[model samples]
Target chain A: MSALLEVRDLTVRLRVGGSDREVITGTTLEIAEGEAMGLVGESGSGKSMTAKAIARLLPAGAGVEGSVHFAGTDVLALSGADLRRHRAKVAVVFQDPRAHINPVRRIEDFMTESLRTLEDVPRAQARTRAADALEEVGIDDPARRLRQFPHELSGGMLQRVMIATALLSRPLLLLADECTTALDVTTQAEVMAILDDLRRDRGLSMLFITHDLELAGAVCDRTSVMYAGQVVETSAADRLHADPLHPYSAALVQARPDVTSTAERLVAIPGRPVSAFEAPSGCRFAPRCPHALDSCRSTEQVLTGLDAGRVRCERAATLRGRLLDPTESPTESEETADA
Target chain B: MPDADGPVLSVSGLRKVFGTQVAVDDMSFDLAPGRSLAIVGESGSGKTTVARMVVGLERPTAGTIVACGRDRSRPARNAGERTRRGREVQIVFQDPYSSLDPRQSGAAAVDEVLRVHHDHDAATRRRIVGELADLVGLDSRQMSALPRALSGGQRQRVAIARALATEPKVLILDESVAALDVSIQAQVLNVLADIRDERGISYVLISHDLAVVRQLTEDVLVMQRGVVVERGRTTDVLDEPQHPYTQRLRASVPGPGWKPTRTLRRPA
Candidate 1:
């Protein structure tokens, strides 16, 4: 029962001359084999930074303080010859479809390169492999798609290609970072199914990073609520949705609008995610947290209780409101409370 | 709710074509004064194009744009009646990052329109700018900040403040809240709702997110590939969608607790 990927105390920093901007601090989470972990956060909440750190794909100036261990190997400690092979074990699916793919390159060309770059397969065989990989991602006509450019395909089709490329690598872990946000809802659901099937069939481990709490609630086995770069709440998937421990987590749940029920007003988590470059004192969410006490301003809470999802705030346990479970039909009490 | 009295704007057989592709086809709707009409559709559904046509940024290939009972002079081909329409109607776009000029401060962005539309003195313009900012919930202190300097929510408020500066009768928003998170979106929407209630300004909101549309608007219009296939009361349309396209669109949107049901096709 060993985890496929174990990230420990990971920190990412952008160094310019002497000054360094701490982008992500104290993010530690793991994805067990065939298990899914939902990494939930707002934009610039360091979810993306934590994802990038896993592959050691940091930009040149990015300095890391912690280890990203994938399958017992400290990926961060590996150098040149070892690190190159280590890099192929983990792949990332970025947020933007526009920037992720090369606009000029054919979808097949990119897919083939992902496979051939690691093992030096014959050009002819790679083409067939690429077509198979494309088909695996729900693209019916892979042969025709090989000739088309990125712009030629719709955003949904392009995102499928992105998943296809990640599958070709046959990585142990996939970092799907807001991959479905840009897609239309029907198409977004289709893409999510593909990922779900891939995880089940391929035994893939995923760190699904997104701002959408609803998507996380539906898919992940476990969820880590990261606010301003720290893991505030870690709970079993059902438990997290049923009863979110953190105040931010509660606010996120309360903020989510129920599609089935009609609402007069959707309560939004007030204020914005703090900018990573300018870290805040006290709780990063304290400025916006409705339950903030005098202690929150002076004390920073470290994540407690690994068994059940834990939060850092002194009032984390005291703030015990439950999140409405999506699985069960809304009860009268739940509806009345939310209403 | 249809009134016995006439609507503020009535559109019938509104069709706009770019070559053979129909951007807007046979669109018909009526908006009463102070009422909000939300047009929800995915990208390329012609929501933006429809908004552009409504604001006189683009002339329709055919149909009548009866505004306040008179057909607007077919959007003068060269001049682009965006400014003339500014006195009565104004458009707010999706990205506040790109919607407002990067260099212009929030105060200047709002006042620039006033300076162009009305030959007002500096003090009058400044006072008007402050009033506009206050209406949209921006404090006087935030007046000097540029678009880049402000957060997405603040910048959107700045955009709304600028749009309100002209004292427009109608506000046509093209996915204006799409760029913001739920919280920030709520904040901006409050400002918009306040505007409609206070000034009796008509709103034509074009968005892909149905929840926002359903929550804010009394009426809803569903568009697919530039043609509106369904139109009704927001709750009615959402509760029991008539058209398949509307059903599918409604299903796709993540509502109060909808988690996209495994990306939404029921695994077909």
Candidate 2:
């Protein structure tokens, strides 16, 4: 299957403090038609920046290199009406819905404004469509909900409203950037289910970005791990969870506190995570990686193909299975036995 | 002195009414010395209200809060009494930045807390501040930098250090590690566990993340709509939750082989 969205050798340089800093360096990824790709990374890893670059939402004084191709169109080169139309084909749902929506506006006006302004739909027809969209997101009494203000709705409800509004344009790709991270766990599950169903029902492609590895794995078919503005590994979500090829991916998996069982102490990554601009020369993750070699720090890391995906580490072959080594701990075994 | 075997903190028949709406209704729990208890609930479940009442941020409509064998149900009589109560319990909020001053460095913040609570000499205050910074894993450089110069995790460590400056017996962690990244959260959790073991201090963790609750707390209280639906040992409550709300909450956490299924019933 051909890719619906292709980002090739994308580099973004942001002008910070009177100097340009490379925020995203040589990052590349693709999303096929109707495929959900998870972009997993820590803060400053450039996952969100990559999304903004693809959506042509970069800030002023930002310089870009490389191409973003969407449905046979150069997204970076789109201008005038073409850019506006391209924006309509791609929608983004942010982490906090409250920050994005106007507080003074009613749900009716907020939901129907895009249709009336962009497509020149009649007010009554747009209101009816907005109500129908609200119902589709499982909100009951859509007419009543549409009459209420943003503050009148709960966080989960407002997030659903945001999703409903995003679908108003019938976009082909949804950039769900931590849309559910701010919600409660049960609400997150419900919202995630709604998003998954919508994607499948509408044959919509998605670029799901989150700091949660397990959440992305559960919802996305493919997962790509980003480190310091570079694509470190991409594989089937379950494969990445069960057997991650990259060392950083393995450490992240080991670092999280497990719900099913308890350990004496989580295997904490020694150093703090660094942004793309602050990353070291050869490998961004080498400083924190436990299995780093002398050569790993001296040479430039490149993505090497393995099966259906790609990994950046040169010693991924030798470090397989050993990356997630269980340290000797009597507390872990005792807890497991108790469970 | 309080009995060694008694609970460090205890509350009974706690209730809070905001005008006509009852935010928390008839809640009760105990925190034994050196033990950790978690109040698990979603937004609007009144878990935060319960914490607020216990910490004297909100006056309860009807209840009794006793910490270290002293009743603090009513407002403190004077500034000295309030300071004594503060020494019994300290809280760490979710957003560390909001709790910290932007202009204050980590060491300066901790020093301010020490100065307010004790009449230590300047040299003693500095020494104590250094100890607090080291306890929270902040180096001398990070301790000297302002809040803006630190990362989110580093700022949170500074908050933890400030909270510990009072040498309180009970720490109320209200979603303390929720704002941090997973790796940073792990480091913080380890730090907390070590502190608990070393100081024999009690913890009351208010959180919605079940995984974090399981890792940090010994006892768990599952709340919904201002009522406690389930309460037991953390392992027993989480591993074998009887209440439907608790079961749904446990199932909601995504992990290996987990699949999200939509439920039509709205929680709030």
Would you estimate the TM-scores of all the predictions? 0.91, 0.96
Q: What's the distance in Å from true for residue B225, model 1?
A: 1.6
Predicted structure 2, TM vs. truth: 0.96
State residue B184's C-alpha deviation in candidate 1, in Å. 1.5
Error in Å for residue A263 of model 1? 3.7
lDDT (Cα, tens digit) per residue for candidate 1, span A31-86 = 89989899998777888888878877888878889778899898888898788777
Q: What are the runs in model 2 whose C-alpha is more than 4 Å off?
A: A327-339, B265-268
- Chain B of candidate 1 achieves a TM-score of 0.89
* Stretches > 4 Å off in candidate 1: A16-18, A322-339, B1-4, B77-83, B119-123, B254-268
Quote the true-contact fraction of every model: 0.31, 0.69
Residues forming the 10-long window of minimal summed lDDT in candidate 2 chain B? B259-268
Candidate 1 falls in which docking quality class? acceptable
